[model samples]
Target: MKTIGVVDTTFARFNMGSAVVDEIKQHVSARIKRVTVPGIKDLPVASKKLIEEEDCDLVIALGMPGSKDIDKVCAHEASTGLIQAQLMTNRHIIEVFVHENEAGSDKELAYLMEKRSREHALNAVKLLFKPEELVKQAGTGQRQGFEDVGSIGM
Candidate 1:
């Protein structure tokens, strides 16, 4: 069994990604490690290296999508948030996510979060069966899917 980390980020300048990681763990296997609510970010490079080197299994990153404007909803925003956040899911397996509180509590914000969550969830599913199929499963989001999940404005 692979040990996986489920992390959530909050207190960002925007609220699009918060309070949602809890909801998406439903599908992962019971053995997957669930990191508490503390966001994963700003770890020392050495620390980050250790986590990656720990040989856990996967370093799944989650995120929420919130924007008044339009974007393709890739894994980039989540990746940036991950680097800037104070938390990181350093494990293997799954990084399931769902949207909770975002930008303005507007319906659009909610919709985007949910959409991103679904993507995360779906990606998790694919990871389970494929594992090495990331490039095929994940879109061209710079560094997310490796980002932590947070608020959804719910």
Candidate 2:
């Protein structure tokens, strides 16, 4: 029953962006709102809006890569000269904490994300956030993603 908020920086690609969003929607079952603007700006605003409007239990920002792995965006300051231009005006990311702390660590990423999502779900349960409504969403098969996402942790 946890209301999770999600923001994605993949929309600059337009149709492809929306398609990616659709896939994520299926995967996360979280509240997602279309955002304008380019990269980092869209993310922070989307994150804030989703939290405020959805009363979200958690906020996640998603960024797609044009020429590199998602991790690379957080890895080198600039993967290539072309990316440097994008980073300058886009997800500037002067210091992305997740990358700075977790990079090259032995931790299993999928597991961590799942664990985090489950913790949010559990918190929603503890707060008596909205069991019956969530149950109905379950009836429609939308309630299982968070559990599966959390399973990535284990």
Best-fitting candidate, scored by lDDT: 1
RMSD of 2: 12.5
Alpha-carbon local distance difference test for all models: 0.41, 0.39
Residue lDDT tens for model 2, 1-154: 4454444453322222343344444444545444433554345555555555656554444432333465456334323422443343332211111221222332443333333434433433433444575555443433321344322221
Q: What TM-score, over all chains together, does every model reach?
A: 0.43, 0.31
| Residue 145 Cα positional deviation in candidate 2, in Å, after optimal superposition | 17
RMSD (CA, Å), each prediction: 10.2, 12.5
lDDT of 1 by residue, 1-154 (tens): 6444444445222232232334335555523433333332322222234346543344345433334232224334444544543256433333333333333455655565555545554455456545666764344443222344543433
The residue pairs that clash in candidate 2, if any, are: 110-152, 111-152, 111-153, 114-150
TM-score of 2: 0.31
Candidate 1 local Cα displacement, residue 57, angstroms: 1.7
